[model samples]
Target: MVMGGKSALQQSAERHLWMNFSQLGYYARGKKLPVMVRGEGCYVWDEHGKRYLDGLSSLFCVNIGHGRADVAQAGADQGKQLEYFPTWSAAHPPAIRLAERIASLAPGDLNRVFFTSGGSESVDSAIKLARQYHRVTGNALKTKIIARDIAYHGTTMGALALTGIDSIKEPFAPLLPGGIHVPNTSVYRLPPDRTADSLAEAVKRRIEIEGPDTVAAVILEPVQTAGGCYMPPPGYFARVREICDEHNVLMISDEVICAWGRLGEWFGCERFGYIPDIITTAKGLTSAYAPMGAVIARDAVAEPFLNGDTSFLHGFTFAGHPMSAAIALANIDVFEREDLLDHVRHNQDGFRAMLESLRDIPIVGDVRGTGYFHAVELVRDQDTKEPFSPEDQVSLLGYLSDELQERGLIFRADDRGGPVVQLAPPLIAGPAQFNEMEELLRPVLHKASELFPHAR
Candidate 1:
């Protein structure tokens, strides 16, 4: 059970496991990594039996919380009935029924579902769907997609093109072309002349400059996650919808992290009061109990393919896998039975209040977001709104990244959006969970602020 003075699990992870978005060199340097072995409710336990609050919902996906026996049982039962099947030119009961259920829950005419294995694939599929929809409708030149700066769409090549973060995309150069970037709704940093609608107007201007006929779709998250939960301003999406309609471009709501009650609604677009032509979703679709995603298209978008002898040339082997479909159905059952959406709606204000109270700490620059997803932006000078220098960011975020974990809290301390602490606890979380988060966050952030005297 031991190898080189480390447990087999640790050794194996260091030698063989390649974690996503993680620096493997950290583990290779013989640092002890926290190996999570069990999860229940709003907490997860490491191999050493240390319990940490699942504040980020294990990456903003575990909406129903962890270790749901019913959800797991559904997959197991489905496996016994039909272990695996492809939805390509064939249908299974779980996929058929789940699609119908999702359609019923989705807004507008987003009834047709094209399945994928996960979020990245969902985004990739959506990108292709938009282009194909345009091509099929006889607009072959409509190929470009416009996305927001600092938005994390996905990691696949197509999705990567849509991702506006330069750090992650540089090495994967020569990505799919025609991916344009626009300013995001980080209203906290907007200049005085810029109004709330200015963010939405950026999309309009980009579409015009790109030649409206050449832009296939506009992809954006309801509340952008990479740049630390940048929420949309009032009437942003509605204006975007109008712009897209005026230009005959598709609006794609990339709801991989925002859907499935993460925003206190079935879909993030619903929360924002606008319906997109296509919705690319995953994550809470099955509450992360199973890897599944779907690109839901409005009736008009799916119409061309549904015509006689015409078909959408796209699919995945595991798309609508029977077991995942069953798990999704079961997950939805739990959502309805527990009324988790209503739970979030009832509790979101208190959660926001708890995070807002942290503004008393000098390092806390801004507290923003909705429902269960929120972020506390770190700053060096709150009065002047001065950002932390690169070195200061390393010192502040590094201390927080390690200190919060040592304090048995699993929240995100990231500089992806310039020094931020993101929190997206499971939707089942309530006041007690919020209190626990505050207790852990208040001190760690206080200690972090001490790293910069100006912040203190």
Candidate 2:
């Protein structure tokens, strides 16, 4: 067996397969094709037999870690008992059970559970639901959605329109109409005089500018992800709620990345002490054991859509698949049994401290994250807080990421957060894993900074 040889399968994949959400030119050149063969616990083995820690949890999924036989068995058992069913007219037991459990865990009047295949589907579903809810309540003209800049809702046509990043939307021009943009609560990028009230005013101004009567809902992540793991400032949600109430616009807390122990809480909105009309989540719901996502609606968001001939008119074929539902139930069981939430609460300080220790490195400008999710923002200036230029970021940061990987750590070299190195280990990770992460990063980052010709 030649090392990483071009099997016909691999060769065909290179020539024919169109990969999702990637820079295809780079892929075609065969620079780095990391073929992850197997995973056990918090680590994975690549094709070359190199084992690296899955610090990013395989794109923030895989919450239960790899190789959970119980979850696999659940899927198999569901496949045998009921291979397929639709929730249109009839529902399966697993779906029903999981929905009730999720409803129980959710806060306030968010009692309805609408299932989808994944986060994007769930998000796409939520938008349609919001539109219908407004139409039913005699706010027929209120079909517009307001999402924050740099926020990512989903990639489906409906969901993509609500996504705030123009870069993603630019390629797919002339998407769904009435989707608007608002200023996000990324305090990291908050203006010099930006107050919570002022930011809220900025949001309110967008709604007003678009004519509040046309707006149906405002969607946001509890913590913005694509903008590079930005945390919400204190009083941000409170002010937003006030603005939403004033505008009669439904507020959506997109907990897709922040829910299920990622942020040391059940939901970020809960931690922030506010109630959103809808909460969308995925990624960790089943610990990524099975593909599953959910859109939860408050009583008000659901009640209107329930009566009459009007329906949300949206659902995925695999939505609430029995196998995924059962696996999710088991994943939740594991969370409770292991007391993972409490674990996150207790150990996050050590995580914070460990990451803050990296601030001494010249390239590390700011290290900000919450609970288990964190990122080290790399920069040029240690004092004035300047970022590396784009070209330097490409060469230096790119080189550093590979070096860190070679040293046996796996995290994100995130350009989404404006030249950051994202560190989001599993919730099960504790002081031991934290120490290992620091060990891998400290020297590698120092070396990377010195290697940069642009280094101050």
Candidate 3:
């Protein structure tokens, strides 16, 4: 029940603009791109003027929802005062306030905030900082990085080296050196009788095999985003923390998608009841109205940078844009005024209940995630929990993704886990929106099975 979007604007963009992360050949061939003109609350309208629900929060940003006069006005006011100022050695009011506010939200003396333009930049910055920090502190050989398999750090060459998805990085061969990957704590694929303790042990053993003295950090998402919205069994994170403590590996919790009330807390580290040495965040910082990202370092890492000739030696030009900082501060005000964190904690149970109802759907193998972020993992066999092969994955996503677009809900078709539909709706999403999502997904999911009759 949605109209096919765009005509003239699509024609113009196709001719003039080069889109990023796209199948250019297919897009250039006659298929019109749906130009998103504007967003309000949880919905966005296309160029042809058809509205669709923003289930992914426009890339898991927009925590406080959309079209807020307060956040927008803060940017305008800051622009009037001082529109452009670099964050070299000089400091600004908005950036200072945002840093203080974020420090308050972050756990365990994670006081240092290094700003960036977006999540990828934050990852890249954090990694370089970790590498340099160890080099200056007499552990230069500890420069090797160990991140989770199937983990997505970022897209930049440096960050991409840390990423674990081979499919994405295969073309960019001979990547940066010494970046290693340990098995993720995804219990579904592990030993049949694996408990939380065993999974943590497996990760620790892998770290030992790599020689802990050589490893620098372990970058992880509190709930894995790429591989079908994978959530670790309980006690997984606490044990990871313990292993890192015993081996002296820095734990970098990538909260790009889980921060800012996404996990019913300011940071996913706090929500999951563990502390990480470094935290990378973006997306929901200014509710997607502005691009911004930050790397918060704990006292252990920041202390070394305080004195001596030690220097991290890296940063971005638009790291802390005045408008972005000002807008982010305003966004924080909105979180406080509306009690958005508590709102997420209150509503998450209802949201999970609604999603669990889809378990009856033939292809739904599992429904997992936390707070405002969740995903439905589809499989070929529900009981045996057998996933379709890679070839079948393309067919399902190509068919179902567009079908869901027709159903008026926008989400991620993550084939990283057979086929998963990632849902990180705006923090403003509640029972009403949850019900609508379930209603829309059920029939369409049922129809998806029809295309793969042999599998089921």
Candidate 4:
């Protein structure tokens, strides 16, 4: 059965749909919802049949790209076999097999997998596991979590508490206690004397100030995704690992947007050369074809509970749905068959260079990030590194966001870390896609330069 026409879809959306993290009033203010109808490879077509490069990989989840009939069929076949089942006190073949596969791919002894519905749940589950792991191991006071400033973990109470973004957490004040924030690894913004070591040192200092005995774990994205794709400084994660180890605190790697082929590695921590005790993952797990997330814990973290009668005490009904597991299995197969990891590894340099070339744009302040994930920070003056004024931020981001989409490029124009444009194209995107991205971005960025003519 075909979906309704454009007007019906738009009306239905405006009348009923409540988009997450969206300004609904903006939609009411003379803007029709851009309804995407179909997707294939690195592009998605809007209701009007206008195709745009899937630059942000549909919120950085479509790792293998869209239109994978094989992946869909795998889930469909699983549905036919067993549509749904609760993981509580029960086991299913798809979940069992997928868990084994994920354990195989996960780094170190992170063998135990606790499935969740999505990234936020995975994070929340990890946070609970961290606290409970310490408590089970007799460090009940170790319930605090340390995260970097401006980092985005998730939106659930526990996860949101761990999130370091002030604006997001402001409205929902008095969150779960014990969530501490430290300086993120935005080396571009640091003083000339502050090296990457400073960022790591901040973590160590926070742990010390918080009293390491009271801190359960430190959760960080290998490359901070929501904080402008900020890649950690050299030796940052290694030192962070050392600090966590020294303090007897677990290190939780939140790879919601960094896992799979996004970082040219199975896990982002691997890309940075550290083994976190708990790894939270989602997004690319099933390439956004199905919703699934997992908290992969090291042996020590899971051992206490497994050895005793203590249960995790937290789970979702659809945590390890058979269909999601089956699709995830097929997703991994597609990754291996297509060599998505190697594809990203090989193409990232070109991808990065294409973005780096945009440094010529006057408004483009700093371009940072690794692998397929990247962001272009905007500023009024490149020399001074002066950020756009509050007025300019609103106007520039609005203009760029609208212009880029109008020009057939669909990515994120985020002000979460100043005015920035982030791109995380599908892993399958190559030179041709890179060219298209630059083709659309260059003119829009050029226009952005014209907006702040005084700076030019």
The sequence of per-residue lDDT tens digits that candidate 4 reaches over residues 1-456 is 123434777878878999999999887786768989999999999877889899999999999999999999999999998999999999999999999999999989999999999999999998898888889889999999998888888899999998888989999989999999988888778877777778898888998998989999999998887758887877888898999999999999999999998999999988989999999999999999999999999998888887768988898999999999999999999999989999999999999999999999888889998899999999988998988888889899899989988888988988877788999999999999999999999999998798764376
Best by TM-score: 1
Off by over 4 Å in 2: 3-12, 453-455
Per-model TM values vs. the true structure: 0.98, 0.95, 0.96, 0.97
**Cα lDDT tens digits for candidate 1, 36-60:** 9999999999887899999999988
Better of 1 and 3 by lDDT: 1
lDDT of 1 at 434: 96
lDDT of 2: 0.83
Model 3: runs farther than 4 Å from truth? Answer: 1-6, 191-195, 454-456
User: lDDT: which is higher, 3 or 4?
Assistant: 4
On residues 1-456, what C-alpha lDDT tens digit does candidate 3 reach at each position?
333454667767777888887886776776667789888988888866788888899888988887898899999999999997989989888888889889988898999899999999998888888888778778877777777788888898888999999988999988888788876766666656666567677768878888887888888898888886778778888988999899888889999988888999999888889989999999888987799999999988998888966667997888889999999999999999999999999999998998899887788888888898888888888888888877888888888788888778898898765688889889998888888888888888888877774344
The Cα RMSD in angstroms, rounded to one decimal, for candidate 1 relative to the true structure is 1.2
Of candidate 3, the 10-residue stretch with the lowest lDDT total is 1-10
Which one wins by TM-score: 2 or 4? 4
* Model 1 spans with C-alpha error above 4 angstroms: 1-5
Clashing pairs in 2: none
Worst 10 residues of 1 by lDDT: 447-456
